[model samples]
Target chain A: MNKDSISKMITIHGVNGISLLNSENEALLSNIKDQQISEAFVFLSSVMPDLEALLAMGAVKQVMLKGAGQQNLSTFAHKKNTLCIQSDPLLSATLLGQQIRSAIG
Target chain B: MKSILTNTISLKDDEDSYLFHEGECLEFSSTKEQADQLSEVALFFDQFFSALRDSDLLYTESHIEVDHALIIANILKNGHILLTITNTAPHAHSNLQHKRPIIQTPRSLVSNKTPSKPLDKKPTALSESAQLAIKKILINYLGPASTIIFNDVYSKWGALEQPTEKSRANLLKLLAEELYTQDEKIKFQAKAEVILKKY
Candidate 1:
């Protein structure tokens, strides 16, 4: 959806940062400031194109990554942009994944 | 702020692009069934350790298994791969009143009684069909670079050559074993093909 919906749909309580990257892995929208958090997303964003390429090639159905610690990242790749969420790890990534999926689908 | 050392997983290619990353919080799962749901942790580390060997990041191929999880940590350029397998289920330890047989990874499934034929050719690029099959299996977890990783592993195995039904079947089995997929159709197809070749 629009810029505001991202905040409306995806909860950012314990989330360190969020970056809405384009197919080029460039952040079209983000609120990451801490250098580590910023570096993390930047490093994470770099893989969006290949993800898109995978989707383009009719490969996987979905792409998600659970990082170490309490942080987890769910990437919803699209033709235009990739929604990457850096949030607290949850019991089931299904809920957060669905929210981001529907919000950006 | 305290850093949560929750189960972690990372996938970075030789080109230095991290396709998947989940490292932010410090909370542990409170459920048992959901414990094994760490797709992020499982997929990344499995490949990360495997990648080290392919990229020559490690002196030799290595892996670790504690309980149901596997870990492969390596010291690379900027960051070292730290893969730790933790059992989140409270019952994982308690419920195991009786001893269970150990599980083996495909890499460890090396058979001793040699093949019918002798070694002849070096590892080559995976056949197009095999690549296509593995791409479909690995793309979800690995993304587009699945092709690249596939090539690397294929060449390393020295499994590639004039494509024979036996070799193709053998390659597919190896892949199916390494990559975790929930889809039964894919699993069934792999098994069926392998059996057909054997028969």
Candidate 2:
């Protein structure tokens, strides 16, 4: 997707920030300024492979984390990269995932 | 020593659900085929979360959706984690279907071949329609995530006892407790009572 569409995806309602990270855990494009949040997501994505192996079930489609006093953090695999979104806790992760998939597709 | 809270939550008949505290398995039930994977995943999560906590970012809850399952982890009041795994793969449905033949067997043969139990002794099971009705009531209060929350709690409720009137009432009470405010719980309880009357 182009930069404009990527920018539009982050502007979705309830979204606080968004980041697109490559396999190296380097942010390729992002709107989130908090390096801590970005690193947290990147670290989470890094564990997906180990989690999947431990599960022996299938690939990790998405992971959502909610801190006590912070915005909800969600990460999902999209094509070759990972998309991390920080949003309001009330936002439906499943619906957000669907929208992301459709937007990228 | 910390007292573990395991009395309220019950694993379903299929035993696919589990509850873990700290790094220990407090409650777990699953088929033989899934036991290994579940245990492995549990250990991995314990280590992973510990590592995450050391990083100075504390998350109280996590939800992981895999291609074949949904894993949910929550930190309880006692500083223990409640990890629940639900199999959502298509093949899991096939395993569920295997149980259908037992229920679909000829009733006449079953009645004739086995000693009949007293009607009052048998617990009533919830019909599909009743479950759907309850779900609708929940959706009004909890919105889209209501479905996932319902399924998780409903499985536990079903495992507690046969879905009789009393059990159904308890299910509503437990679900109502999920609401944040006392007023919402009261309103939810009232709305749920209407469904109970119909069921």
Candidate 3:
């Protein structure tokens, strides 16, 4: 609706496809990779407790298992969709999660 | 002759300081490392007990002779647990380690009723049409926007993944009931229940 609706490049992934919503609520970038991954997140999110528990246990903040060079996978959920955010590493993941939540709202 | 396959197991209470393990083995208190591992095991059993308490769950006293070991259980009390892993001794009668009953009958070992077939068939999940019916019910209960959420749930719980084909009907009913009860108002649960009975 407005420029502030999605200031950053936002992609709302559903079970079917990924919708990259622009500032005007338009899908300027979109595709569907694997539907199974999103469905798995939905199932797991229903049965899990807050991620804060892991955080409180002093779990690793950002766990990145590097493959050869650039291939990285963030291991574990969400109706559930995953935001494949090309996030700024310097920025807080928590803050990014908050932003994503607000955008969904 | 006590088969060398048989050994002793012990359970111990480590909830407090200086508690000894009591079972069929020599009594000894746990070291700090042992105590830590035991604590986690206690939590594990607690979760299992909680899950089984209300269900039609039952167990009989028996040992699992896996490989070369005979497992045994200990009494659980006052946040204490004990497990004894007994290893079958070498040069013992290997047949003594395990025994399985075998009954040979002509046609019907069971009652004269028709024999049930083995459960070797692939699971029969909800047909796409059946899934759509449930989706339609959900849409009516909530809103169209819920398709996204339902689709997500569908991805997670594809009806075809059920191990037993017979339970597919009941599973769909359970899923519908869960969705309704989880979000419906307390006053509306009865109505929702009535609606879900159609499934």
Q: Please list the residue runs of candidate 2 whose C-alpha ends up more than 4 Å from where it truly belongs after superposition.
A: B1-15, B21-23, B77-79, B90-199
Give lDDT tens digits, candidate 3, residues A1-105: 224534433442312233333322223444534443233223222212212121122221221111122122221122222333333334333354455556645
TM-score attained by model 2: 0.58
Q: Interface RMSD value for candidate 3, one decimal?
A: 18.0
Ten residues in sequence with the least summed lDDT for candidate 1 chain B: B11-20
Per-residue lDDT of A44-80 in model 1, one digit per residue for the tens? 3443333323223232223344533535544555556
Per-residue alpha-carbon lDDT of candidate 1 for residues B13-71, written as tens digits (9 for 90 to 100): 11111111232111222222122233233234434334323432232212222224223
Report DockQ per prediction, comma-separated.
0.09, 0.27, 0.01
Model 3 CAPRI quality: incorrect
Clashing pairs for model 3 are B11-B82, B12-B21
Looking at model 3, what is the TM-score of chain A? 0.33
Query: How well is each residue in A2-104 modelled by candidate 2, as lDDT tens digits?
Result: 7776867776788899888887667898888887787778767666655665555678888888777778888888777888888987887677777776667
Model with the higher TM-score, candidate 2 or 3: 2
| All candidates: TM-score | 0.37, 0.58, 0.23
Of the candidates shown, which would achieve the greatest DockQ relative to the real structure? 2
